[model samples]
Target: MTAIPSAELHTPDELLANASAMYASGDPKLFRGAILESITALEAFVQRTVFRSLEGRLDPLLVKWLEEKTRMDFDSRLSVLTQVATGLPINKSSELWDGYKKAKEIRNKVVHSGRKVTAMDVELVMASVRDWLSYLGTTVELEAVLLTLKRWVEQSPKPPIENEAQAIQLVAQYFHQSAAARITIEAEINTGGRRHRADMILDFGPRKVLVETKFPRLANNVRNVIRDAVEQADAKRQAANIGQACVIAFLRKRPEGVSDVVERHKGGGILSIAIETH
Candidate 1:
């Protein structure tokens, strides 16, 4: 996934790096930015993750509701999201969540109480934030990644990809670079003693997702493309150790936003999504 290293803003990876640099510099003044960026980056990532991973799956009313909650408390966001979003909520009483809340308080003190932070504060916050990332990556992050790619067609930097290969390239690049996840393109899988190639594979630590992409200009093509990908996924699912696999379809807008996101499922438990791009 892309780490977002460009100059405009810092991604969590960049913010964490800045925190480390500031701590290494031994400049007490810089520690505050480090501390602030560290916490802010975590907050930013949570919102970004939620939107990119789950927005397309939501009803329009829920989309508006989430927009209104842009400034909602993080815990409240998590609480409400658990009601609507997939994946089990991180336990509030667990050490991981509790430690993160404690770290968040330190961040709040810096902003509201004008508290001066030292290197030790930076260390504590950094460790806790890193732990949070690790926990998410190893646990429920697979669901998050799969959910994100279910709307893979929406992530296209350029709309109207010309063919299946181009569509695969676009989403694969987006996930491999932006999601901070590992991916393999044109990966080979064996089924029924014969070998076939799947569009892509995504890795979230121990878990994985088999991805097949489709670009359908006509509405009728939607079902056919989805069926084709499901067959492919079913073939590779057993061979690849993937419990879940998905097909992402980018539909051209001749009718111009004629449809929102349409999802389909096969008996083999494969999911397919069609997102219109205008």
Candidate 2:
């Protein structure tokens, strides 16, 4: 297959368009590879734009511009980009930083390792591409606005107030939005037995669900975590009149022991949920 010509005058929107086209081409392998390439290109563009914009004085107009153009909360949005773009050793941030790390890993396997890229992989890569493009568009637009603001600040006679409120508000909103159910972590059990802190607790009305997260990379660890969670849940239930209680062994990746574990625990209330995070 002939390679598509590299996009010239690279822009976030253009990169996104190319990705969409590649995804629509009906070939899973090609689509996945193209999406990865598009992400790489988009990240490079954002880094360049951000560095160039930062050369001049910071100004409030930049914040206004971001709000007006992207409809994102000014402080929160800028902080996210800055953290990923600056203070990081990599010129291009990690794929995980942009939430595409998992997609990139799958793409690498499909493209270089002769692994078959599934339709689900293509769909996921396409979604990641879209998110990358959206982030790029917002960042690029902010850079342009920042440049304008810098010029205005340099020439203006009056000094502007330092708007740290935007930064504070941004952090607060981020924590609020990403907030998860609080699960206590400890090293001992109430029964004077040694135990690991609860990894996660899911409250379901009359039933309480407990989960221990484990990486599939370690088979024994995964089994142990699941077993421990189940045992803990069982113990907790024995002391109280709880309804529909179960311990979940959660794996972020598929493990080889999954089948054996499931078979052994068949008809038991123990469950497993496969999750992947980027």
Candidate 3:
């Protein structure tokens, strides 16, 4: 497969520049054209970056369906596909998303029906698109999260978390105190029709993840405990658009036994971390 030439990839900035130029020309007739360029910018970002990111992350068939067969609107790409492939959670109800959705509607009215858009309409689309792009730098990166956790667990004194609850609280506090990013953690998030509570729900700006904690002191099958936590997290994750993770804190010490369960699920997007006792 021939790679897409880098020069051919249109960034949001470049397209926005063109859109802004049109918007500033003082022509209502060109307002729709400007909005059209903005929509193209969104598509370019998704097609160029998102599809490539999913090469090995998702199954080939699903990836094909998502990229080719599915006629995903902007909302679907932002709210669903991007999250599935990249773990970048997007809350559709956020003010940024709400604004982009309005911009999309305005663009649709202009493009799909050939209707005239006002000066305010063009400004709304430009502002909304820029707002969504501003968070790209801060979106959740799974490796970064795991790296942060690794550092937290390896601290000199170690986190003195005794049970699952303490682990959750301490983990939440750790994220809150983090200098790089102050993640918002909510406790006992009800997912799957509120049938169960996810131990800790973290908001990483444009991303969200539900965490399940396990503190097994005497359990013989530690692998099974971790696997069960992964399954629980996966279920909760599937119920919503958020990502999932399992944080297992050892009350005694880290179990040195596991048959690739940790490695396998980490690849599956349910990050399982063990806080070893030092």
- Stretches of candidate 3 above 4 Å error? 1-12, 137-278
lDDT of each: 0.63, 0.43, 0.61
lDDT of 3 by residue, 1-278 (tens): 12111112122355478898888898877888888887787667666556544544567687778887546565677777766655655787788778988988898788689777888888888888876654432222333344345444655454455676776765665555433343445445456457667766655454465667677776466767877878877877777667445554454565567431123264446666555645
Candidate 2, residue 151: the lDDT equals 34
Worst 10 residues of 3 by lDDT: 1-10
TM-scores for all candidates? 0.62, 0.34, 0.46
Off by over 4 Å in 1: 1-15, 51-55, 58-62, 69-72, 112-120, 133-163, 169-183, 189-196, 202-210, 215-246, 250-272, 276-278
Clashes of each: 7, 1, 0
Query: Which ranges of candidate 2 are over 4 A from the true structure?
Result: 1-13, 57-81, 84-98, 145-278
Error of 2 at 100 (Å): 1.8
- Tell me which of candidates 1 and 2 scores higher on lDDT: 1
Superposing all C-alpha atoms, what RMSD in Å does each candidate have to the true structure?
6.5, 21.5, 11.6
Candidate 2 clashes: the total is: 1
> Residues 1-278, candidate 2, lDDT per residue (tens digit)?
12212112233445556666766787775766665666565455554555344333245476446435543332333345443333222224655345566666776687688777666776677666556544443334323332333233334444322332332232123222212222233222344354434443433232343433343345457666666656666565344433223332323344665432111132233443332221
Candidates ranked by lDDT: 1, 3, 2
* Model 2 residue 270 lDDT score: 40
TM-score, model 1 to reference: 0.62
